[model samples]
Target: GKGGAEAGAIGNISIYDVDFVPLLDAAGQPVDPNPVGHGLTEIDHLTHNVFRGRMKEWSEFYERFFNFREVRYFDIEGKLTGLKSKAMTSPCGKIRIPINESS
Candidate 1:
């Protein structure tokens, strides 16, 4: 992004990929500091293991525990389709959450 003002005017901008590494503990093991932030591990891509439960209940959990506010949603309609969601910053402005409906 060479042009400061020009780049801002144009909506197209490349946001690079993210390789997340969970904070490790002293014992060289996955630290279970708490239920929310624990089981320290790192993966290439985003792999979400959503628990089995109701949709509204899960959404509420995100709101209550994580303080995530549902920003956008999409309804899937194909053979492998379901509900898609994007929850934006509620507690921290830097965080971005995207949760899909459980199959």
Candidate 2:
């Protein structure tokens, strides 16, 4: 009952430690790394979409429950649509989630 529909679309949050197994050749040998690539180390941020009127509520929820503080606010306007967003980050600054709502 902890992370049921009460949590909305963000049902549950789980972090896992993943081991990356290298790509192997036909002979069971690891292939060489990409010459022009710098591999990804970790994720920096994520974005979540909410209903137009619920952005502030979700932002407050993240601040209260996850220790995420508001870092930035954006109001984007296009020719046909507009949106508002609030960026929230964890204390360590490694995680960020931007809550967006279309207007």
Candidate 3:
């Protein structure tokens, strides 16, 4: 799996599936139902770093396979570095992924 030690040795990012289980205390009782607090429900979005000049390719792939649509574009520049990003979201608006490329 991507989260295994072998994968970790090669890169910092690991892609894998997770099943959520209730948190428990020493007494085995479930911990706070809202562990994240502040009324946060679920992960709203995720970001991916893409190879420079491949943003268009990725955007097309997501749009073709996942029915995602490009919603926004961002260009952030700083003293030493800059990046380009495009945000895409699923048809239902529940999933959002922003692909980025650094300059």
lDDT per residue as tens, model 2, 1-103: 2424243333344222112357788999987768456678789788999998999899999889989999999999999999999999999999999999998
Candidate 3, residue 49: the lDDT equals: 99
**lDDT (Cα, tens digit) per residue for candidate 3, span 32-79:** 865564675778899999989999999999999989999999999989
Clashes of each: 0, 0, 0
| lDDT values, one for every candidate | 0.54, 0.82, 0.84
RMSD of each: 18.6, 12.3, 9.3
Highest lDDT model number: 3
Q: Name the runs in model 1 displaced over 4 angstroms.
A: 1-53, 86-88
**Predicted candidate 1 versus true structure: per-residue lDDT over 3-80, tens digit per residue:** 343433235552221122355779887755477755656432232335534556766777899787776665555786
Give me the displacement of residue 55 in model 1, in angstroms. 2.7
User: Residue 70's C-alpha lDDT in candidate 3?
Assistant: 92
* lDDT for position 82 in model 1: 53
Error of 1 at 63 (Å): 0.9
Q: For residue 65, what is the lDDT in candidate 3?
A: 94
Candidate 2 collision pairs: none
Model 1 residue-pair collision total: 0
The full ranking of all candidates by TM-score, starting with the best, is: 3, 2, 1
